[model samples]
Target: MRALRYLALAGLLATAGIAVAAPATYQLDPTHTMVLFSWNHFGFSNPSADLNNVQGTLVYDEKDPSKSSVDVTLPLSGLDTFVPKLDEHLKSADFLDATKYPNITFKSTKVSAAGKGKLKVTGDLTVHGVTKPVTLDVTVNKVGDHPMLKVPAVGFDATATLKRSDFGVGAYVPNVSDEIKVRITTEGHAEKK
Candidate 1:
């Protein structure tokens, strides 16, 4: 009957619509994620720093940048200035205050295409128990099924700068660094249901 045929056609159309409208989700792999930074020391030399406790999720719209978003967290206790003593000092109240705020987090409120494969990720950077607005310059490095996990994932390179003093980290002013540089290379792996 024509009624049955119409029902079948409607079902097919609904399935196609769902496929076309579904949003893409990419998960971040903590092992593959890296965050780095460097700051000037007394306006004479620059010292490098890296943090290794990055973990989070990234839901990206491959076909539409407007639908993309990111959530990331970097543990402050993992601060590495390449020196144990300096690292301990960094965790102190004068710096990160890891005891009070163990994590530095980024939760994107908006994402816009920066043209090419780059995107502008605007979010809150919470550090040392203080929160501030920060923007990251990001580039999608890769997107595909992860080889080891067999899950949909996205990789990105992100960079941002912050005024350390603004976060209440004003211990060594005029001698240490004023601006803090943060660089991130991350992979988001989709979570399994």
Candidate 2:
């Protein structure tokens, strides 16, 4: 009877341990993570800008994807339009007002599996001091060991659309097109234990 009771207690403890397993944490690889955005320019061309060196943390739960979360920071200083003059203009008081609000950030509120290797991530995106809820259609590019780095890594491609007016960044609304198409690609490596 004593041995049976001990076995039962051990089994209960094991079950509890499995139920409480924590999600894996990954650190975003700054060099490989970037945001690209484009807007129509005077109905002639679609000009784009790239924001590089994104820093973030991702808590991923493979067993239950809904438990995942993401938090990222994008520095306005990293904004590059390829044209030096445009870069300065974008960071000036007219557009992003980088001097006043230096960083753009996003924090995930919910994560849900959309389909096989896809997810819908809803989060609060803060830009130009305005916070708004935005949803990203995310595709899981790969989740596995890195070939060169030899560490567990994950990759994702996400897209979203927003209006510049919503974030108080509208300068040339109808002319430049207020709607902005945003694409993000990121690679993250597992945090060292």
Candidate 3:
């Protein structure tokens, strides 16, 4: 009986240790993260834009994916569509009105395993002073030590689609394409807890 108790205690301790190491919080590495958006330009061609600034905190639970969470902030001022004139126009009052609504944010409400190495993240997205629910399909590319940064890191590829009219961003809807497809590739470094 004594030996069995000792063994059980050891097993409990080991499980606790594993749980402690399983969950890690990573700070978004802005330099390694990119958010790109694409929309059909009058059904002639798809024009894409890039959002340069992004910062967020991601709590990843490898063992239990349901425990994972994320909160992200994106600045509207980082809009860059390659075309200088169009970029300026996007930031003006006619479109995004970056001066009025300078920031976009997302807070995860639920995180669940979609499939092998994939996560379905449902969250609230706030943009242009409007908040709406958004769902993202995220695939984990890799989760381990980063060679360049020499730190624990996680890389992910995620995609989401949002309607411009839903967020009050209906500038040239239907013509410029109301549906915006967003693609994000991010590599975040784990922060020391």
Candidate 4:
């Protein structure tokens, strides 16, 4: 009886260990995820646009953050500049050419901890049919059960700067500013097991 009890205890401990080390998968909440981009417009003003309805999945490993990964899709149809004419122009052949490349995507190649609650995520960003490696500075906003939904959730904010010329979107170059600043905020909910 003593030997049997010891074996059972060992099995239970091993099971607990595996559970703690496993990564959790979260589906990004479209309503809570948004991407914002800004750039200098003709040196006259800084204009910004917002893209919504983002879809993505995040596999987060709390024990080993390096094992985590991210994949997201941003639809150009959701892009809004607030001004109707400007929005149309941006989507036309002169700029993004939305009809040809309707969606932008990012797939993480590596994830590393930067500091406490921060990370350096390097990924491939595809824009205008060109793919470029980009690194984003990410801050973990929260990682726990959401108050409103009462479900396991994670939130993060990330920022990056990229040159439009690199992605074949350099229509105005120095005039409209080749560099673009991008900010992303996302909340993801874990599917109930």
Better of 1 and 4 by TM-score: 4
What C-alpha lDDT, on a 0 to 100 scale, does residue 132 get in candidate 2? 99
Residue-level lDDT tens digits of model 1 in 31-126 = 777788888888888888788877777778878877877787889866888889989888887778889889988888888989889999898878
- The sequence of per-residue lDDT tens digits that candidate 4 reaches over residues 57-124 is 99988768899999999999988999989999999989889999999999999999999999999999
In candidate 4, the residue pairs with backbone N, CA or C atoms under 3 Å apart (3 or more residues apart, or in different chains) clash, namely none
- Model 4 ranges with Cα > 4 A deviation: 1-18
Full ranking by lDDT: 2, 4, 3, 1
Q: Global lDDT of each model?
A: 0.82, 0.93, 0.90, 0.92
- What is the total number of backbone clashes in candidate 3? 0
Q: What TM-scores do the predictions have?
A: 0.87, 0.93, 0.89, 0.91
Give the Å error, residue 73, model 1. Answer: 1.8
**lDDT tens per residue, model 2, 43-85:** 9999999998788999888778899999999999999999999
Tens-place lDDT per residue, model 3, 1-193, is 9999999999999888563556789999888899999999888999898887798999999878889999999998788898999899888888788899998899999999998999999999998899999999999999999887678999899999999889888887889999999999998897654
Q: Where does candidate 1 stray beyond 4 Å?
A: 1-18
Ranking by TM-score: 2, 4, 3, 1
Worst ten-residue run, lDDT, model 2?
15-24
Considering only N, C-alpha and C atoms within 3 Å, which residue pairs clash in candidate 1? 27-188, 27-189, 27-190, 28-187, 28-188, 28-189, 29-187
Query: Against the hidden true structure, what lDDT does model 4 obtain?
Result: 0.92
